[model samples]
Target: MTNPQLLWLRKNLFNTWYNSLLTIICIAFLIWLAKSIIIWTTTQAQWTVVQVNLRLFLVGRFPQSLYWRVWIVLAIASTLTAITWGVFSSKQHLTKRQIAVYTFIIAGFLMGLPGDLTSRSWLLLISILLAIGFGIGRKFPKIILPWLSLTWLLSFSLIIWLIGGGLGWQSVSTNSWNGLLLTLLMAAVSIVLSFPIGVLLALGRTSNLPIIRWFSILYIEIIRGLPLIGILFLAQVMLPLFLPVDLRLDRVVRAITGLVLFSAAYMAENVRGGLQAVWRGQVEAAKALGLNSLLVTILIILPQALRAVIPAIVGQFIGLFKDTSLLSLVGLVELTGISRSILAQPQFIGRYAEVYLFIGSIYWVFCYSMSLASRRLEKQISQ
Candidate 1:
């Protein structure tokens, strides 16, 4: 090889060697640091008492009888995951790094020396569900839609069954609800409820009728103007007064309703942006082709509009996910609420650092993943 080629080869070799050596050194240092910290903390701190009450931190005072309900919900959620994977199988692919990160997360949940009151069974079930969902998504992409629909239907049915059987919703009161379940439920419900309402609001905003446009504008502006905490307060305190005396809403429902309304306002704005971005010529072309306005908007415009704004919608979702923590302020025990409540316990006093760190890590993982996914979608759409 020429001198230039030799230099290139040497550069590549040096780069590889440098990276390998750095990685090895970093790993060794991390292991040593972790060992030293563990020794110091265990020797100086009283962790055994905390470990014994770990279950309280994880699930709070959930009734033992309703533990099965939580598991059933988890199973249903797993099935839903499998179905979703099936529906979007064509679009699904996981990088090795993603797999490694997920594996590490599972290992942490399973092996981390948390309080001895941990629910190993619940963790086990979630792991199995995730594994099965991933396998099906990878192997049977075509069946995803039907599978997802079936799982959703089953879940809804289960929800109805639980409520009707007089199992009573109080078994899992809004105050007692905490941890990952609350976070997932709030996010899932907010997204589900907001999308249609957002679509309607978007359409109304763009409608030619003055009344429709005015109403839509008013609703969106007023909702968007208020802080989420204000809306949450309305939902928790004021909205209940408007309800019939016989019709009492649960705190969780109120919080979810508040979230859905608050999120829909933002989602409407995003959808409207997408709609506005669609070329007027496309609408005119559809009209000239003898398509009615409804068909034109629905068939020709909305799909592209939605696709164009998916990243924005995803951004809104991630924001909503984080905002769900605010429900803690109104006495709803979501993840942050749970962590704060745990810290208030006499035994866990002064352990706010550990608890908050763990909670922040969990929130960071979820929000970061959502942000990454949104960026990936943006890239794909731009391409």
Candidate 2:
């Protein structure tokens, strides 16, 4: 039998002379581009730059002896992700395809790490353990679910101590934090902390209490009115001034604070839109059923409202992930900042393209994963 793909291509691409010509030219260009990229990457490009600077790219100037702390942080994250997937996924399984895709994609770059054979083995072990963790959580959700949130909360505090030190360990100043680790920390912390604040702000904005509503309105408007960079600058410049000298927040903490506050304001608007999308009839229906205001909102209104706005929430999360790069403006060296550090090195001078490309690719993969997850969630919900 004739190939199905070939028949479809003929129908779509060869239906007319102009269409056939266009398709041929496009195919030729793609092939040429692919060949050029392969040649450059394999022959001309100095990928050794990436391999040599792996530590700087991943963790910046963070001390090497303290690297185990990063592994523990990763384990905490892996467990939390497993539990989350087990709790929320329709299949009672973490989506293996997505996890595998990201794992291998990252491994491709990181596995080549020079002189890091043992660490690569550990990385693979962690990946396998994460899958096993997901299975354990999924199978014993009734027994395990209660501890999941508590574990995450504890892990949050533990991560801060491990990364920043000072909890029975040597104090590692936040100023030394940089690289992809810092980028991810800021993004994750901002998104996590922003959620509860956003929910409260959303509820307050919709409250019948005029004072509460107006105060909520004021905060959201004031924060949202300014550019995020301006807010970040203010946080960088102003936060330390108000604190007693001994209590001054570290630069990373200040950046996180600024990100959370700015993101919460935007997220409040997203949540408010979600809240608004709930029909008046739904509220009335719950009220008619003798439900109190809080019960009506909690049991009837919120679930539907949030479900309707999943895409918007995900979009905001992706934006927050990318916006974390803005911390470089305040002298915090996250991914983009780390890239600049690499470029500034005498040995890596004129390698701006490689460094920037690597940084951009990292950002792209993370943002793209969020976008894909959002779409998949929307599809699942609609179905």
C-alpha local distance difference test of each model: 0.76, 0.84
Per-residue lDDT of candidate 2, residues 7-97 (tens digit): 9988999999999999999999999999999998788888767888888999999999988888888877776776656544544344778
**Can you write out model 1's per-residue Cα lDDT over 1-383, one digit (the tens) per residue?**
89998787566544687776876798899999999878867676555434665555556666656776666776666556544543344364677697668756864776454423435656666676776676666676655544555567567767545522455554445565676667777887788789889989999999999999999999999999999999999999999899899999988899999999999999999999999989999899889999999899889889989988887898898899989889889888777877777777787788765676666777888888777756655654565
Where does candidate 1 clash, by residue pair?
51-115, 51-116, 83-148, 86-144, 87-144
lDDT value for candidate 1?
A: 0.76
Clashing pairs in 2: none
Off by over 4 Å in 2: 1-4, 86-113, 141-150, 241-247, 375-383
- TM-score (all chains, Cα) for each model: 0.76, 0.88
Top candidate (lDDT): 2
Given candidate 2, what's the lDDT at residue 127? Answer: 70
Q: What does candidate 2 score on TM?
A: 0.88
